[model samples]
Target: MAEQGAAERGPDGLSRRRLLAASAAGGAVWLLRGTVGPESARAIGTAPVLPGGLVPYQQVYENWAGEIRTSPLWVCAPDSPQQVADLADWAAANGWRLRAQGQRHGWAPFTVAAGTPADTRVLLVDTTRSLTALSLASGFGGAGGRAVRAQTGASLEDLLAFLADQGLGVAACPAPGDLTVGGALAVGGHGTAVPAAGETPRPGQGFGSLSNQVLSLTAVVHDASAGRYVLRTFDRSEADAAAFLVHLGRAFLTEVVLRAAPDTRLRCLSRVDVPATELFAAPGSPAAGGGRTFADFLASTGRVEAIWFAFTDHPWLKTWQPAPDKPLFAHEVSAPYNYPFSDNLPQPVAELAGQLVSGSEQLAPVFGQLQFLITKIGLTGDVTDLLLAPGLLRSLLSGDTLTHLLAGGLRSDLWGASRHLLQYVRPTTLRVTANGYAIHCRRSDVQWVVSRFASSYQQVLATHQARGEYPMNGAAEIRVTGLDDPVACGVPGAQPPLLSALRPHADHPEWDTAVWLDLLTLPGTPGLHAFYREIEQELLGLFDGTRAGLRVEWSKGWAYTTDAAWADPAVLGRTVPATLRAPGAPGWDEAVATLDGYDPARVFGNPFLDALLR
Candidate 1:
């Protein structure tokens, strides 16, 4: 590989370009921000003086994938919850909207829309700065079970670690640890898990999203008598609190008290030998060969994830089983991000990824194979040539490359506290653009759902491949979890998250599980949006209301057209609300009306949210 000379090289032998490519594929925070110098970064424009002596700064706003960027945006970090309420009142008075920002790790234009004008009357309230106070709720054992009160800006890593220290933890959480508690709850983020065989869920242990664990939340809402936005606390049982549980950026939550259970050790095992065909096989089809299908694992442990690399025969399967004590053969880990190879890219993988992203669209298959090989070698420490053809192996890997990648310990089987295994993906994993959805179906139809979707995905890829169009060079990730059952929160009369993707369909009471599917790809791949649109349409049509329903994962990409995401009017106007709840029905209508009632001025909305959430 040619480089720009040693001047652009890092301390390692790899060039900066190779390092960047590797980072883009794995560990870097994919972003492009404004280049304004610090001297003027804090320069206030025509904004009125903020309350609490807060000085707003001119900053660039960009989402995780750099797909949404706005420059010269005014942002501020408040010191207290009262300051946020004051800021909201100021925004309403000054004809400006306020959007709460935390880590900015989401895909959808929930925070700020693409092509937002530099002079847009939107003020971004950054919560990660100083409003991250956390503490245990008083009288933790009353009726709500064990609980912790954390400010919205507190990171999941910190909150989970705090619970772990006290011998308490939530049953499930998102893989990334950097996500804000506020952001995760607001979007209904979830992890892969459900009840295994005859297992019982302990009190406060919910199989649904983080929002389902909320005991109470404090938010800045309108106070009719006060005639301004004021901090208000809402218990889980309140009708309005149901709307606030997963507001989708339509409201600002300053703090929340969440239910937690006693922490249990977990044993996570990884394997790369499961052929996708057999693993995703139909429920009772002989092609399954009575093999270890996705449903088989789901029934056994209830905690499983399948990562199938594009154009690959085998998918990486990880199953986490509850282990009260560490298994004798399991490697004990103390912290999260046990998969080092995934967090950091190897040289060969980085080089090929650079070429692929640089316009060698034909290299997509090769890149996919390389990624699978890396996982196989990293997980099981298998360096045998049998994994790849001799010619391709000789071309892509050498003794030097193997040595560089094998420096880390094998993570095939790991046993540790729940936090260590539950949060494995670090901020550095491949930052690809993803289109996400949740297919609701009976728990018995897990394999059926997986098989149908996988089959459609393969046909779509084959069609694109026949035309030499490789819009996806990444993988398809699938996981299964239970729906948001409010009983798990232990709050009597508590309503489910109205906007959560895992919210059980009111009409289909038997559909208990949610199959989460996300298709990942490099951000700028040609024909990507069209490819995604085809998949989205196929999914919506396939799942209709017959036996399953499809709901858009609010945090990721969706409503795709030929060129952009969140742009399909038909989807936003008709399909989405209809899927969640019948149009003009209670679930959709109630949430919208409540949110509108709280912020009648729409001071908490952006253009995109106003359109989709209307």
Candidate 2:
């Protein structure tokens, strides 16, 4: 069970018959045959189904976190809706809880409990492989009159690639490429964009969250009599729809329908060694003068992104444009893909320069080992690499250290000797230096988040300076998008009557475009979070609740909590319907009454009717 992915779990834990039956009840259930010896089943209140030989528990569970493992009492991989329905029924009769697991990337224990039958008991519906159906559905009653219907198990990368093949593409997306559709939608994954004018915005809205683009969804609900009911909903229902979009199927998500845009090619440009202070400063301000200001740059380009290196005075900027005008081309640029200090490293660094410019996985191990060394001595690096190959030094530091170094360096350069008295100063300075500059290229619509994160051109220079980190002295691009959907989170006040009403003027196509702010930070530094928070707060203010807010990449460093304990119960109570609420099932009259204001019966429910009713 330890150190395994989903593909490696042992089969000895449960019986196939019991697993199927329990899974029929809508929860992850293990057959007695899979978990215990044939004789031990009696003690657990279930008889063992010994027909197929036992498989070891080690072979069944596969998790990515490496810190925890789970052994479901029953694991069911249902291929179709009917199979899912049947499994729900069986779990209800057997008194087992149901858990729908996808990708298993979550660090929390929401999917499986530890150290009890609860961990191995009940049925777990694995979505990793069961659902692979992907196709274009025409005349789907929505805008554009066409949509892409994806089964719950499809990967986002595959989905985008598939769509692109069909001459279509995702309007926005998160940075990492490996995320799955189900996982993204369930957890409210987001992308970055500036809302168009007249778009109602709110606090904390991030464009990367997938909930904004969902056109429709299908969920399997458990009812009072332990029967499974399928529920469907469209974009119009506000309260229930919003709740469903954010909810990760305490029931089950069977399908997702997304509204996609036509495929288009984008050109990309990059710049390195730019001063961070001048990049993100406010428009027309003195601090942002003598270089392309972030706002002005974004206004001129198709898209813009910026990356700043900590402990150094350079920021990388990238800009992209649609294809045909500029043609597609790949670069040999180096940057972090994940945190610089993550356990997953691409390779070990043999030189100081290699540490600065390599991507995240490649940089983390080097940074950690060197950081340990630096703790004993002082921060050390090759002087030649510091001046001529700063990227190599960046490849070696943890993201926290990098951020600190950059902030410290910026503070030192801007404020001179006065910065030495700060509270967070390091005992020793990083031995790296650089003269930042910009590179020009066309914009790309695909992989906007990645392009922005990696590119050094579009970073917010002023924010870095305010925090004592040197700002990139390059353009920090930003664009705006008009708010269309009322169901989308971050729109202030009640949901809009229709999305089109908020569209920008017809004369300007770019007027209503979503804003993308490119940013960069030093690797292995703790200041990244604070800097991000400040930027988020500022963006939320400038937008003035007229559109969706900023998008923070959760997998990278944004630590979001799924714990309901921290959630505002009143908000939940107001947003979720009484019938859909946990524990007590609503009476038929109550359900009907609840359905009166909103569209009725499209929402799904769980099969434990009596338990829900109680």
- TM-score to true structure, per model: 0.94, 0.52
Please tell me which predicted candidate would have the highest TM-score against the true structure: 1
For residues 1-614, what per-residue lDDT tens digits would candidate 2 score against the true structure? 12223333323443222222232232233222233432454233443221123221212343332223444345556667556555555555445555666665443344553323533445566676768688886654434424688887787666766776676664345444455677767655544344322332232222334555566667665444534443444442443444445443344567877766555443344454345556655434576566565554554543455544333343445444333332323322112121122112122222322323222223333343343322211212222333343454445554654444333211111111101111111111121111111111112221232233333332443445454443221123333332334434322332221111122222222333344343332322224344444444344344322222233222222221222111233322332122122233222233333332231232222232222212
Where model 2 places Cα greater than 4 Å from the true spot, the runs are: 1-74, 105-122, 193-209, 223-227, 231-239, 249-251, 328-346, 349-614
Candidate 1's C-alpha runs over 4 A off are 1-48, 385-387, 390-395, 582-585
**In terms of lDDT, which candidate is strongest?**
1
Q: Kindly report the root-mean-square deviation of model 2 from the true structure over all alpha carbons.
A: 15.1
Evaluate model 2: give its TM-score.
0.52
Worst 10 residues of 2 by lDDT: 412-421
